[model samples]
Target chain A: MSPPAALRAAGLVKSYRRGRAVDGVDLTVALGERVALLGPNGAGKTTTLLMCLGAVTPDAGTVEILGHRLPRERSHALARVGFTAGYLPLPERMRVVEYLRLYARLAGLRRPDVAARAALDRFGVSHLARAMGTELSSGQKTLVGIAKAVLHRPALLVLDEPTASLDPDVALRVRTGLREISAELGTALLVTSHNMVEVERLCERVVFLSAGQVVANGTPAQIIDRYGHDDLEGVFLHLS
Target chain B: MPTIEVYHGAAASFWRVMAIARRHAYVLQRSPHRLFDIIVWPVVDVILFGTIGVFAAGRLGGAGQVALYLLVGVVLWHVVYQAQISLATGFLEETWSRTVLSLLVTPMREWEYVAGVALFGLVKLLGGVGAVALIAWAAYAFKITTLGWGLIPVAALLLAVGWAIALFVIGLVLRFGSGAEALAWGILFVVMPLSGTFYPVSALPAVLRPIGTLLPTTHAFAAGRAFAQGAATPWHELGLAAAGTAVMLALGFGYVVWMLRVFRARGFVTRYS
Candidate 1:
């Protein structure tokens, strides 16, 4: 039997008065599958992710996370999902450990200290645990943000531009961490990034979005083959 | 079973919010200079105003009477101003640090987030009020003994008004970006002189009185002054104030909801490119 889909959105329609941002988009991700959402700047990839996370409501469509609808049943859905975004940083006044502990508790961890420490260690930033969030470098902040999201070991992880500002070495560490988390916890991963090579290296499948629509969806190699491109970057540039 | 699950989840969310509040409070505690600034600014203003009144007693009202009046106005005005500005600045800090979007994606609803910010604002306002009241009592034996209980209702009204103003400003912040801070400051400066903070609304120029009446701060100041003087508050006027505050809050919240919709629709979430 196929594993249950960790997240599913059907006929998702989100529009502004001026134009549609996401036009009748449909997407699904099974447990433990790593899917990369690839799109240009205004392709509505983040809108789709925000809708799935229940941060933004779709004008028309249904979204289910772990088989639970959003906004109405969001508490149940969000409890099982973890998310990170380049646009959303942690509170600057908060210490790394304090912020992690707070989110860990929110994510339903009983002993938040242990969970926070473990997450920090996993990302190899335990030394910076007591530092203020504002004091950290961009790469260090990204690691802590990711640690905060995954402290409860969520079954579904949604990350947006997770490695956008990181050094290549730190980005590789994060990539390794994402793969390890998916493997160990059987967590489905849906991530959006500008780094096509990172997506090619880390994701099992890729979904290409253009002008608020999913223009292509398939395995990385299959998408490359279908688009007649040398690699994921070539395909992304062609579609974008 | 579903009910029990919801209960557990709500309890958990409440604890999480409380935890964030506690962390924030801890940070405030560590930064004693910030706390000192809140308290010290009011004291310095009181002294400066009191001195001016004393020196110009013949030109102004009786020195003692004018000092007492200004004390009430300054203390109450400070609370309203502090509450509004602090809440906006707090949210601005979150936006600057990119944490508002982070919290939005959590299980927390928009209402809960607003509640948390309002709660923090309330704490800050109360602290400032308490410090000012204490200093006034110590220095001048100032007492609003008969009107003490009225402070509660006045504070509640002012808090609602402040939160409403903050919400409207937050919508602008989310839409126009950090430039909203300058707008907020400008609005506050324009509103303060007309708010009857230093004098009665009757003292304003005939044309300005109508403008003053349009502000919630005018009603808040009237309510607070009545409470300070132990005057019988006109319930009709109090009701009108409350109603006006409620309308502002409702409109502010509605505006925020609409702005969020617009932000989503416009793809602001992914417009970094």
Candidate 2:
């Protein structure tokens, strides 16, 4: 029998009082495969991510992370999963090393400090180790956050708009680090971003959502070709 | 790297809990305001209130009895308040830093987080409560240790009451978000007056007596007060408070867990955006 996918979220549904936010969304990310979920505002992207992370219970459907089901086996699933997002910033009072070390321990690493240092080195941000969260610039914070997330080297790493706020140069650094993580660690990447250029550069495939449902799912080049657009952004503009 | 080796069971839970406490400790070590909170204001409270208790002795015609009554109440009040504030604010710290969702995604369970914050609170209030106790002794000739071995149960019941109240407030915050955040401090306004922390339950009016009696802290205070007035061990009252405290913990912990589920179901936790 084949190994289960790194992540399989099937037939997911969610609703708020206003209306259904996510409707019958199915998403899967294979081991070491890089995929992005792209959508505009109110497209239910965050809701879907939260459900898959087991932070929000689904109205209907099942989500499995590395073959461990969510909302039921949430603890076991979370133990092997690492997540980072721009919205969830690092703790302002904690130094970068302190934050990473704590998460490493939380992930049950035997040598959290060593693992944290290796993660910092992997992201090429070892100089920011002693800086407090309040001291780091936005780009630096994102790097530290990624290091913290990957410290335990989980099978899957979920990132939300990981480079959304950075300057082009810093964004390049982030993209390079993420690509290395995907290639060297074989960490399955499930990303959400509006940066179509970065999506094309970093992710092998794209899943586009509009009004709470998947409207397009293919390789960036294929999606662009299918829509007769010059690039992924043009395709996005076409969909929007 | 597929190097994920997730820790499991009780031992892992211990380290996870300590990780949370250590995170707070780092904040505590660096933030001046946090240090002020642990030391300055609580010490000021002891001096300010202990003076009142001493003045009330003259006004109430009991020499030192009224002093002990109010002073003992104030000291224990700090004990309970410290437990509640420490836990509530520790949890609040996560929200302010926007790390609550991050912590949730980790292998750490909800109970472990709660216990960790409560554990930190326990470590913290010891210094705060001890400082207050020392001042109460030096300034007002009121040594809490005079309660002797009885001090254990008195402080235990009071701490239980504090934790119960804080847990419920946390549940409110989880379900309602910051709309209920004020209760983290404001609820104490109602709790302090209703629990009769400053006076004897018998001193309260008939309409309010039953309400005061219902609080485990009230029963615990009654024992402390009886001892101050030269009665030996007030086991009957202590016994009652202990039983009441057990009920309170069950209700408080259960309420928080249910609210957490509701937070998940209603997807309020997605507000991290």
Candidate 3:
């Protein structure tokens, strides 16, 4: 089968009155590829991700998701994408099953219940499906958040700091699930996280952003080698 | 198949908002204290003001007249209070739970989101108003003889005005964070005393009449009282009030739309950092 671009952004520029938050950045991801966005605080990582999801508009740029332009025609584009952010949580008062089913329906799933349960089982959180969202621990909440994002089986997945608060074991389980999702569904995965080890292990490619600009772009190994670091963390510290 | 798909898409958006509202209502159900606070607070205000009217009957008006007047003011005030508090608190709650960012990423537009929240607020306000009106009617024989079909339009206008005020408050909250809550309450206090809510505008000092006329609630109360008293409403005043309400609503909605643009531009939607 011929490869298709799952996501593409060109000349993405977003600015506040004081200064630019994301400055003329460009990026692309192909189906079945797992890309990690690496950056320190104030690096415009989240801004880039929000722009891709059409949650924020760019002052100057073009974002095409699965061949659909963003912001101007985001409804069609978003229907084919799923997103999660570290700061955004599920409604705590809602039951896991209720929240997931609601999002599944919103994602246009025909069988929301089955799809929601399948996602929960995929993440090994099936037992918590009936529990209230507020009752879940931090790690459990993160897992549920990821499950909700993927339940729709979108062509693209964007996760912002997806595993920031998880313990090692839960984080590993999440990574494994993400890998399976990409391999099985050919979904393009673009994720941002501060965990360099996880990025190095899961991502085939890495993009390093610093102060609202792209500073590095290559494979994890290649980027690390060019920065003359043994690991992604060392490379991050060197650049940041 | 394409038509079915389109229908499904629209239904999904509707259901998403309904789900949010349902979950919120459920949480509110669990917090009986909050429910009681909203429902009972207005009732207490009516009783307190009613008693004060009774003691000052010689100075103000008769017990029945004072109760009739205060009941209209209290009910209308409750509507405004409920609408403003719900709008501000609902957005704040979403922000606190980080759910607003999640919703922003969805296919729903900003107008649709605001409409859904406003509808929810309207339902809650109407329920509170109904309960208070029922109680006052039973206890004090608060007769509303001319409260015919005409009252429906007045109520609808009042609801729209309340929602508009709430939207303005929501914009303030978004701009200044939780500190805006204090400002909102302070503004309400200032308006309540000056708007001829508890007493007639005629009783107001000559200097304050213009200030009272500027308030939309002043017109709402006057219209409501006229309906209750079986008197011909001053259509000119009502028309002017409706125009003022429309203007306020347009300005309030405009400010909210502007604020959302600012929030999106600044990446405040995901600015948890």
Task: Give the higher-lDDT candidate: 1 or 3.
Answer: 1
Clashing pairs in 1: A89-B98
Which model scores highest in TM-score?
Answer: 2
Question: Best-fitting candidate, measured by DockQ?
Answer: 2
TM-scores for the candidates: 0.85, 0.96, 0.90
State each model's CA lDDT, in order. Answer: 0.78, 0.86, 0.77
What 10-residue stretch in candidate 2 chain A is worst by lDDT?
A108-117
**Candidate 3 structure quality by residue, lDDT tens digits, B139-184:** 6555333466556656766776767777887787666666676755
Candidate ranking under lDDT, highest first, comes to 2, 1, 3
Candidate numbers sorted by DockQ from highest down: 2, 3, 1
- Chain B TM-scores across candidates: 0.85, 0.93, 0.86
Candidate order by TM-score, decreasing, is: 2, 3, 1
Which portions of model 2 miss their true places by more than 4 Å?
B1-6
Local lDDT at A16 for model 2 = 93
Interface RMSD of each: 5.9, 2.4, 4.3
DockQ of each: 0.36, 0.65, 0.46
Ten contiguous residues minimizing lDDT sum, candidate 1 chain B: B1-10
What is the overall TM-score of model 1 with all chains considered together?
Answer: 0.85
Candidate no. 3 TM-score: 0.90
For candidate 1, give the lDDT of residue B75.
69
